[model samples]
Target: MADLAQSAERFRVIARGKLADPRIQSAIDSSTDRLRSHRVDAWDELGEVEERRSRAYEIRMRAIRDIDGNLERFRTALEARGGHVAVCATAEEANAYVVDVCKRHGAKLVAKSKSMATEEIGLNEALEAAGVTSVETDLGEYVLQLENEHPVHIVAPAIEKTKEDVARIFSKEEGVEVPPVLEEVTASARRQLRQVFFDADVGVTGANFVVAETGTVVTVTNEGNGRLVASLPKVHVVITGIERVVERLDDLPHLLSLLGRSATGQRLTSYTHLVTGPRREGEEDGPEEIHVVFLENGRRNLLDTKYEEMLACIRCGSCLNVCPVYRKTAGEAYGPVYSGPMGAVLTPLLVGIDQAPSLPHASSLCGACTEACPVKIPLHELLLELRRDLVDEHETSWFERLGFSLWSFAWSTTFGYRLSSALARFGHRWASRFGPGRVWASDRELPAFAKKRFRDSR
Candidate 1:
């Protein structure tokens, strides 16, 4: 937030590119509509959406409240199963663990499934710096990897790219010419990754949930890449946030139901893998070794706080789909790995609120994210909490503070509110005199305020 001019220029470039994409509206409408519809159908079929929501929220709350105990128990359980566990307090520590493990294993080529935690830690960049070839196996991730861009959406990383854009990327890569059909694009990618996965020395992934009870990691994905990434390489590493660990194995189905409904609108994803420990002595299909790294980064500080419930998010992008600001600005404007309302709240919190001062203010406090969240995170309330942090933590600039203070006093005083309302109404009347409801409004109007203040009418 302090380094203003440079950050502003970066965001301006992102905004211009996103706003210029004519297909953005259609892209959002098509995917969000399908996702929302799928959620409705899935929940209705389940016949106890409310019941599941209640239980899921409670389960997450209980786990996060006793996060330390749960994490310790998880560590013990995972260790007991012959798996090694590492708890990292920062992204640097997590990256160190991965690089050390890869270097120890002499991993020259690495294949990875889609992992937000890896992105959060800039793992690929770190691995590349350490001379490891990290490949993105998930179709969408592969697209972004090819184009050299960050994911624009969660769940659907390449949502911003149309078929033609994808074709351009692949066509250039392959040095071939043809229509950029989805299946064709997929085939080309498959051909490219087939050898990489076959030859990789290590496979890395992110876990959706870590079941402490079973010492297992769960990953749900539509693509089969998660399975390949987990099973093929000699060593498999699962990177995830500490709060993704739920208390009981029984809570999985309830969360799985919500994740599918919220993420892709399916009752279930095509592939749901539950891997416990490394491969057993006789198992031929799974990896020979397994490692789980629970990353705290900054989550322990949120314990018992207002935002603790955000841990229950399950990483579904339902909130993103409905966020108007996210719709307009796209994910790059968030200036972090996470995007949309959740990103707006999470990026600042996990990274450092001071570095991303504008993120919390990007929202309109519309409460759409809260409503759309399958597990019911109060996203708007979280936004307010982040905003309050800026002031309470003294993260605000003098100019912005003065502006907000003036605004707060104006809206708080009845006399000031009334006067301002009258003046705004009068100004609108004067401006509208140019035509009948023909004011030069692009997105909204300077609608007249109430004819009289509420106190007067009452």
Candidate 2:
């Protein structure tokens, strides 16, 4: 996997190339538009959408305020039900714990649900290095795995892929000719993964919410793969961020209402699994050994920071659908596990701003992401905050600092402002002879200066 700097640079190069591709732009526009429409319709159906969002936000705030206490309570309750909990401070520690679990169980094959935490820590890569096969059971995830690609969207991993792209991947994987028909493609994947589910020695999943009150791990998936990955294997391991813990069982309904509506526009997902613990004596189909890994992975550092509201995200992808930047470039452009507006804020915090210096500037700050957020995270404000922090840290180049300094000086006085406007008009006239004002705007002309300033006209 690419490190932060490499990833950000790669995104810049790839995004520029993708911008020239009509097919990519078309696919992104169509997919996000459909998701956006569905989200609006779903919220309308729920009624009192704003009220529910406020309630959910309050619950998230309360839960995060005392996150440490809730985690401890969750551990106590889970252990009482014969479940093991491991609190890992870093990705290496989390991966080590998972590797140890596989080793202890003599696991050769592991089936996995679609979990961004797993992707974040490179779990599959680690498992392969340990001589185990990790299979992605979710259909979208399966397609991505076959293509050797990362997820493009949080909920819809392969949203950027076309049906023909999927057909090619499935055909190559199955060593047979596959049609591009949606139903046919799904059936083929289901047929192939069904046996893997039964044969895998261990199952790995991520929880949507860990109810502290019941010590239950709640997983919501449209596909039944999450259930299979959690239940069919003898050992079931959950890897998730510690921020997923909620204070009460009652809080789940409120969050779920927003999650389902915002994610795929369903009132509720097709499958919602609440696993309290490992199988008891009389229990039949659940895993025999249950282990929950709460990964800190830099999250604890953000608890009291200005960006704590980021923890309120449910990985709905609603922000991505509505974000102007994301719609045009898609998730790959962000070059992180989390993408879009949330990624702009969280990636820098988790990975450090120096590595993703350009991410804060990736937004138009149109506030679409903030408006679409189910928990009402002020994403645009967070982006601005990140930009401010970057400047404070001196992460910006001297050239940018000089330009901003001059611009600030110009705008500070009336004479300077008027003079700057006249200079700007002259600069625009000469811009064509010199070169494009911005590299990305080479094809477009700078707007003509107004005939007269509004203030001067008045």
lDDT of 1 by residue, 1-458 (tens): 11111242465467668777779766766776676677767777877766777887898888888888888888888888788899999888898999999999999999999988888888998899999999999988998998788887888898877888888888898888636798888888887888888999999999999987778899988988899999989899999999899888998988897898778878788899999888887788888778898888787777777778877778899888888888777877876478889988887777677777778887889999988787878999999999999898888767668767886898899888878676766676675555433433433566657778676787
- TM-score of model number 1: 0.90
Model 1 poorest ten-residue lDDT run: 1-10
In Å, residue 120's CA in model 1 sits off its true spot by 0.3
> In candidate 2, how many Å is residue 332 off?
1.0
lDDT of 1 at 412: 97
State the local distance difference test value for candidate 2.
0.88
Q: After superposition, how far is residue 331 of candidate 1 from its true place, in Å?
A: 1.3
Clashes of 1: 0
User: What is the C-alpha lDDT profile of model 2 across 4-69, one tens digit per residue?
Assistant: 343436667777787888888998899889989999999998899778888888998899999999
In model 1, what is the error at residue 416, expressed in angstroms?
3.9
